[model samples]
Target: SLIVKAISRLGPVARTGGVRGPHGVRSEGAFLSPLLALLLLLLLNWLHPHPKALKCYKTDSEASNLTLEGCSPDKISCVLHFRIDKSTGARHRGLSNCWNLNDKCGIADCLYTPHSRIEDHGSCCCRTDGCNLMENLRLVTSPPTATTMPSKGGSSQGNRNSTSKSSSNDSGSEGGLFAKGGSDQAASVLLFSLAPVLAICVTVVLGFFLYTRHRERRKSRSESVGLASYPVDNHPFPVGHLSSHIRLKERLATGKFGCVYIGEDAETDQRVAVKVFPPQERGSWLVEQELYSLPEMSHPNILCFIGADQCGQGPDLRLWLVTEYHPLGSAHDYLAGHTVSWIQLLDLAESLSRGLAFLHESSSEKPAIAHRDIKSRNVLIRSDLSCCIADLGLAKKFFQGESIGDVHPQVGTRRYMSPEVLEGAMSFYKDSFLRVDVYSLGLVLWEMLTRCTDAYGAEGVPAYRLPFEAETGSSNPSLSQMQAAVVIERRRPEFPAECQSHQGLSYLRETICCCWDHVPEARLTAACVAERCKALRRLPVSVAAEEARRRQQEEQLADQQAPAVDLQLPQAAVINEASAAASAEELRPLREAEDAV
Candidate 1:
């Protein structure tokens, strides 16, 4: 029938171009013969051996009715075997499964014996799907007598042994498929019937994929600006192996998107940090993956991404990102109840600035990405106490040749927000976004500098306080409160005047002030801050403090001796001199230390 349909469909096309043979016969038959043969070969290829195993219910007196798949095709009967408890004489629940057929088994209904202790001889066997259902428990409980069993008579034996006999010839035949010869024709017809639908579905899916890919390429080319397009990772991860391999030991932190946990690798037993996000936080998860997948993104000062996974499902879905773990936790926790030396402060500042600088860098494979949320809590520390920037959840990417236009200006910690961000007047330009990060860096540097041991001279480092905590008097300030403090009042985090004693602290304090400058244009870049940190470490701070003090006294004496009042700014000069004298007084201990050196 398939061949006839194929020939009839091709008949119209062949007839349109048909030529007559010498004896009034069409030469189209010549082409039709080869087409028919090809169709036959295709048909043969389509016929696959159907899965011949029968599915049967299985239970050992359990509440579950387990469906057994891929049982041996020869095991055509479903068996229910139950025994009376030896002492109680009470019939227990039956054990039901696909039957194991043997030579002594009945052609249709076979009884082995009235009763047997070991072989479950009284069990009931029937050739039907789920025939072992508990509704038929009475069949197993009451065994048939020997007289009621079908005897293997000569006629029955002869009929079963006959080579030419068909299964249909026996009235009690189970209708089980025995061999490939029995079902080849049926299997071939079934496959050929369903082939076109399967082929169309596959072709439609493949063509849709190709069309979407081509359209994306054309759109990207149209937006080209002499720079390579950003590379996107497919981001397939080992979801199956996530829960099986990594054992989460303790929860480290929790936030808007998800919770972080300390997980240990089952194989290597190495500690790893696992950030698990809920299904709704997939956007943040993708952002983290994209930032980490960028070229040259792996730095000593950035959190390392090991892998990602989809653990559990539905309401319990968790988007997990695994990374190398550090024991010191975050800068907030590290600086709590402790103080750091000037050198340790420099180390933390430099490494953090370097990481932020790299994040704002544009490469062939990546656009400039800004970590919009920069805070002491988001900054993690390694064993050496150097800082690495973490948590790219709120990060934004700036692809080349695109207008940033307007943005969601109100972001990041309220205290760390820049004047422009707090006022909601920030420009949606690339440099503007990066400067926000630098401003937050400044606040964080101030947070760390507040804990610097030598900054306050004899007073020691004051207990750690977040930026603007002194004025606001709250760890978490409201948006309006911050806007008033940072934008309207132009108030920044204050430092003790005595911090000017150490030259390095003075330089660092200057850098922090520059970072959080009221004017965004005046703020230093992350790279510049990193360089300043390195220079502070190299400078002889005590000697510099001494030279600054000597220069201050000389200026004071020179101003006292030289003629004044040339300009009407004498009061301004007097005020500046008075502040200089205060700085001079503040640096006396630093000068003594320099002298001692």
Candidate 2:
């Protein structure tokens, strides 16, 4: 029970501020009352109908045998009577109300019968309440017939009378219906004839615009290529001949695309890492160069880009990207040999986060970039123990309103791939790509923590192991193996229990967990991780201790400056008189000394 009480004190306690029994149900009614009232209010609102105003009968022919009584808040004035077929007496009646006055067409002319094959179709709309009633609709249903003639001479007279009557009927029934139809036909013919020409013109203009844009882009690419292909003499560093000017000392590492060598620039006597890419890997070399050459790409946390040059031709061609040589080499190499202290671990995490944050930042000069392949190997540690991010071959730039280019699905290292990337369900947005980098960063952080000697405490540092080495037992696990372990099984690199015992490491563990959340959106941004790392580096434990000590000192000084009181005084009056006399005597001496002077 004591242990339980002690553990319970670690977390927050919610204050209900009400009565509670042994089972905590005595105040149930208090909790339920407000909830019940809210539900009742919602139910009452749902049951109430909208207020009725001007009511009208509405029906559509398509929805047969269905009639709706619609009421508008705005007083309805117009009623429309439409007859689709006069012979069959098939009709639909509707009330036009200004429920939405902005969408309403005011005049009756706006509601007209469309030209149909049936000649008896007509509409008579009027602006009066209930004007579309059945009684008012009897005006045009039946017309008087022509009278018959008695004899052969009378037949001609009857024919003339019938013709006059028909003409009058036609005038009453919508004037010049055939003439209006003829005009409509003429307009439609003109539109049809010109539509093809307009479409062709638009298509031609669009094609021309796209073609010109493509040509301009191609020309720019060609110009850039021409500039890049210029002789080594044109370059700032001017490695006249790669073999003659640069002495390759030792092969540091080999990657899928290239091999890195610790080389000395013969002319300047400067140590540099020369990344030599074969002819087949020239594309990656070019991409790296382009990224490095971008404006505002320079940062302390980012590996310095010196220069790049191509030597030889055909199969013998070798592309060389020279960068500043760090004596400490990669974080992976450093960690493999030596276990870092907690401070060194924090520094490594912070520096790495800063580099990633810098790369992911967007400005007017450059678009944000994602270091798709962020791992221990890609992070280089300087002599000062601070790290810089390198190997940007798989890096991608994201501009506003533009999608990230479709990369080969399996471009990044299998171990560092995020859940979304592993499942091939990644959204090609800037944030999604950045989040992938963050997930990899989390794995790298785990790697740093595992390599910290202090993390294991008295048990001593654990043997260096790559992420998920326990599960897969291989440093280079296959894609399927990683998917099974990381995605299907949902296994993360084991955080040592000893590390979690420490406050700083515990906070860092939480950060790592948040960064590598299976849900990509739930992961923290690189900038956020960087800020957390920076905060961690500030050493909250020490800061808090210092603050407490300062506060204690302040309280002590305040106590010392406070006037003492004699609780054992014979009387309150005597104490007050003594204090007064003491104050007066102190003041009198100062006054006398001033007077003497």
Candidate 3:
């Protein structure tokens, strides 16, 4: 305060009662406040400043002309990307373009200089307008690859900003401009007083950082091989790792999510199936990722998952779930092309049931998973005619005692929905939910049988048709139409009389009936179905009468268990969040919407 008054008096003074200066002009004391404000304005401008539009030179390789292009509204810098081939040492240059602030460029708001060098990619960015000219853009210390791809650039920016903040805070906090003597003395006393505390804090922070870095290094080394380390984060998996390794080929199939593309790993050259999901189906992609990440989820009967990733950004953002490729395509298409023998039918059924059983049956400490949508189209056939389950977008998991999450009860294909699901009387209990999948599995099994030439050869094996499509006489039956046919009339897929003559087909027909039974509680579990298929497979068409008799005995024992049984019939099991089951009358209004699923 004393220094301020002395300075104001020495410079020029103007108060309501102050004397005049030599020139007879009176200066007011209010001017001192304005002087202080001007200093604050300068300091503020140095600390926080808004960026302006930056212009860069866009080199047109084809036209051989240079045009000035302004940075996009979301971008804050101009970048020059560069790449080099390792074998030939050939340098490739990407045209200068607008870059985002959080991009791979580690420096901005300065002259163009190579700042971020990652792998083979190196780029420099300048926030200054017209600074990214064709002449100004030149490789200083770049490797070969470019585009300012994000890696260490964000951390570099943080370090730079932190340095600036420290300097600004140190200079602005002390009264260096107004009272240098007291400010210096006070700063020295405070520094001496807090030196021990500051030292201890710095030591603790440094030690924690080093320990974290060591743990990360060990974790990265352990997970360098497989996807065991990959988490179910919403963001893309190993952003740079997948892009560099997988080389995508032509599209294989298209579905509700996106398209399936055939890709090969660059390192192994092994073929992979890349199932892509659109931006709108991101939730489905995440669900599939979580399911795949479960412990011991991998099985020979189940599709082998490699990893999941994201495609481009903005409007082109697409999610990718990679798995082992099967060239023969889905069972629906395979059965349409060629008729299957009785042995082939057994193989497909056995593998399909085993896969489903693995999914529905919990392993290790993980919860059971129910694939709500089970159909021939979602089953892929290998070269050996063995099948594997795929497309788990609508799958749900059941924990032992924990509360279940919200599931869209009306989701899954209507053609495959069980009677309980069709009437919306199904509870959210673990066993009841598994029963729903079993019902759909029965429908799929019937469809596969209808295509087997040996089962109904006498009646001139019928054309490939869905479960109720033959009964309803329509490819896509409405919910009202299905309920009227399957629920009201209690009709199932008809098995030709000739099928009864084949011992194997006869047992399978019986199994199908048990699977799609009207009573959800009486439906056969996936494990039971798998066991039945295995036993039936032993008694082929030429098997002896004794073998057939033994198979029948095994089937009877499978149903009546001595220990814990597969079917746990819970009468009126209302397990969903304090809410009663939606009755058939309640779901009557949603017939159209349910048909769309």
How many residue pairs clash (N, CA or C atoms closer than 3 angstroms) in each of the candidate models, in the order given? 0, 0, 7
- Candidates in order have lDDT scores of 0.68, 0.65, 0.66
What lDDT is reached at residue 303 by model 3?
Answer: 83
Summarize candidate 2's per-residue lDDT along 1-597 as a digit string, tens digits: 432332232232222234676887656444434334333333333443222444444545342333435544332323443445566766554333222111111232323333333344433333333443444543332332331111212254564564345434544332122112223223323333444454566556556766887999986774356324533322336543555578888999999889999989688877889999998886788788878878888889999887777778778888888888998989889888999877788889988998999999999988899889999999999989999999999888887878555576556999999888888988867888899999999999999988876566446787888888898989789989999998899989999875544456776888899989999889988877877776665553443333334334434444653243233233444544554454344335433532442
Q: For candidate 3, list the clashing residue pairs, or say none.
A: 14-27, 14-28, 83-144, 83-145, 84-144, 120-145, 121-145
After superposition, the stretches of candidate 3 with alpha carbons farther than 4 Å from their true spots are: 1-240, 266-268, 541-597
lDDT of 3 by residue, 1-597 (tens): 442443343333222334467787654333344434334333433443334556876666442455787765445567655555667745455556665443223343322334443445444556666555534544445453222333223465664454334334454432233222333233333443444554566556556766887998976764342434455333333533575678889899888877899988777787889898888887788778778878767788888777876668899877788887899999889887778877788899989999999998875567799899999889999988999999989899887777776776766887888777787787878888889899999988887888877664324576777778877888888898887887788888888674665556776888899999999889888988887777665445443232334344445555776553334222112221111122222324333332342
Best-fitting candidate, measured by lDDT?
1
Model 1, runs deviating above 4 Å: 1-240, 405-407, 540-597
Q: lDDT: which is higher, 1 or 3? A: 1
| Descending-TM-score candidate ranking | 2, 1, 3
Number of the top-ranking candidate, with TM-score as the measure: 2
**TM-score for each model:** 0.53, 0.55, 0.52
RMSD of 2: 26.5
* Every model: Cα RMSD to truth: 26.5, 26.5, 31.5
